[model samples]
Target: MSTTALSKPWTITRLGWLFQPISDRGHEEAMVLSVYRDHGVIPKDSRTDNFNRTPENLSNYQLVQPGDLVVNRMKAWQGSLGISEHQGIVSPDYEVLRPTAPEYDRRFLHSLLRSRALIDQYALRSTGIRPSQWRLYWDEMKTIEISLPAAKQQRAIADYLDRETARIDTLIEEQQRLIEMLRERRQAVIDESFSTLGDPSVQLRRYIKFLTSGSRGWGDYYADQGERFLRIGNLPRANLEIRGDIQFVDLPADVTEGSRTMLQEGDLLFSITAYLGSVAVIKGDWVGAYVSQHVALCRLERDRVDPRFIGWFMLTTTGQDQLNEGAAGGTKMQLALDDIRGLRVPTASIEQQRRIAAHLDRQTAKIDALVAETERFIEYARERRVALITAAVTGQIDLREMA
Candidate 1:
């Protein structure tokens, strides 16, 4: 965790790992081998599908030995560091490093390379010729410097982190499992509400006094003026794509004239278009936008159904089925407003809607907490590994005399 500006002569250039031995033309046809960041146990691949190689588009190079720290030179900043415990052919973009001495643990080295500190430094050094084509060169990668403790201290640190992080990872996995269970429970709740055996509920159509059809097509609003014009693709699959990142088009002056379709808190935005059942609840008091041709601005009768509950249901299996079953297009499929308005919905009393929403809110909050913690552990486990490598190479953690 310390840095110094001193120069050292003990540094040796890395002869990146070799990989030609793992490739072969077998079974029926020639197959290309490749390695991905998900290859090892950190993400836990329980597949027998040869984590080594597959038919990939990229050329393969560099045989990575077990325990060799492999990094994608270009995407090193994006946490693409992994410890290769099995030999595999991967994209030539990978730069595999094996420490010259045992002072550094390979896992530690891999983690350090992926640490925020190293990643930020890598980002700072990178140059992007285009918006997407950014490159981080390997030659410059070697010069990254770090201060480290002695060899004994290095091993002690790695061992300490390995034990602590494993426990954290286990907890994270359990929390993640709990989140999935909550999701399943939420789906069950939806299924029960719609079933005839459940408490009395209202038919979906009764709530709407005026269910008008949506504005024509994308062509009708091309001339619209200064307001957020939302399209089907613009709507996110899960959470609202925090607005700053969402692309918006200006509404023509004529369309913005007193549109009741403006988004509001508790308003349920439904896509009755191609992605027929996708739904999202307005998170806060967002009031500027009007729906695109493909989206429906549902003014839900809040007395019968909670918009939040509807949003959740649409994302669940039952709601998806209800949507898919009502779908009515040939090639580029879509569900018209009439098709959706006539669709049956399971409803409950106001008190019940609030209760279901509150229960789901609590469960989702717990799931979010677990996801955040797991992410943090992933970062730490990754960083600790890299610190071990930085320490060993700089002569700060010396293992030259130990075998």
Candidate 2:
């Protein structure tokens, strides 16, 4: 990290990428020239809209030069700003700004565009408009003031940030790959357990006790209301992860009337409808509201079944087959209360079950640890990339001097 100050009185302006006049093309024919999301441009091929233009339309549409500061006027608040280095055409909705002054570093302009001040301006200006469609009018956006850094200093900071952020990105990618591998190994563990059990003498229903779904007249609540809510959307696919589909809700008094519905350690949560059969286990002390209508809370009778074993089984082929078969409904399949009650499972003695679960847990934990370390490295790389850019632009580190 470098402690460098930028030159004073930095000027700011909106770079309208859509400088060229619209061609003789219909809105539908106007191929999506460019798409920006999360501080990066969406690849031309991955574009879901028809805003990006091919070379055919490039001549008629406005152009974006390399290193120009461009922003998706509509989504600037969501960080849809980037340095346009690719030879690509963007939607007419975008405003591209090329630095008018030689003293202004293009890289410095880009960083400043993404700074807190600019983003806040976009947010405040967005008042009452649909957040997704709020556009930054260049006339209004260009007047936004900024503290300027010396041209040389600006270049240095930009260079520093680029190098450091690249390192962080590499680390994150490695961690993601390792996490995938760990999950695969964990899946194998589950598969092996089922295969090794051979023929079970005990009947599935006799040894296992599956909780039936209760009444389904629960009302809804907002996530921002300060309640910890779990929905079926939170459950990950077998051998996958839980990432942000589910929302939190404030706990309502009526839902927690009895202790039976309260979520606890070792309980398996299953989706009943919508995204049918996705599952996750409550591993530790989790304080949250009761399940939504789309989910079923399963509690295993300890005397008959091991909670960990049941969770593992659900991850295997056998469990999935049962889940699919038991699922009802056409478009959105659902597993009925009776179907879950009737599903078969392999049960073992408490000692055997404990041994198997512990073994798998240790192996998975080791893999998770490796992934976490790689992720930390990725964070360091990201910070370094930003710092490098900042250093180059601020003149704390001179790239020209090194050359």
Clashes of each: 16, 51
Local accuracy of candidate 2 as per-residue lDDT tens digits, 1-403: 3344433444443333222222232334333446465445444666556453465544444455565556777777776777665645565566666555545666666775665556777777654358866777666665555555556656665665666666667677777787788677767767787787864344345544556443454345555655445666677775333435445556467755434566766766777886655777775424444566677777777765777776667668777777887874466578766676677777677888878767766766676677677667767766665555444443454344422
lDDT of 1 by residue, 1-403 (tens): 3343223333333322211123221222222233344443122134566455434443344455566666665666665566665655444566656655545655555555555566677777666875256666656665666444444544554565566657666765675676577556655655554454353244446665434324655444444345565567656554323233343455555754426656666666667666666776665435666666667777677766777766665655666776787774456577766765665656666777677666666665565566567567656755554554454434444343331
Which residue ranges in model 2 land beyond 4 Å of their true spot?
Answer: 1-31, 47-69, 86-93, 96-112, 115-135, 146-165, 198-210, 220-230, 233-267, 274-277, 280-289, 299-301, 317-329, 338-344, 394-403
Angstrom error at residue 148, model 2: 6.9
The runs of at least 3 residues in candidate 1 whose Cα sits more than 4 Å from the true structure, single-residue gaps closed, are 1-62, 96-104, 129-131, 146-154, 192-268, 273-276, 280-288, 299-317, 327-334, 347-403
| Candidates' C-alpha lDDT | 0.55, 0.61
TM-score for all models, in order of appearance: 0.63, 0.68
On TM-score, the leading prediction is 2
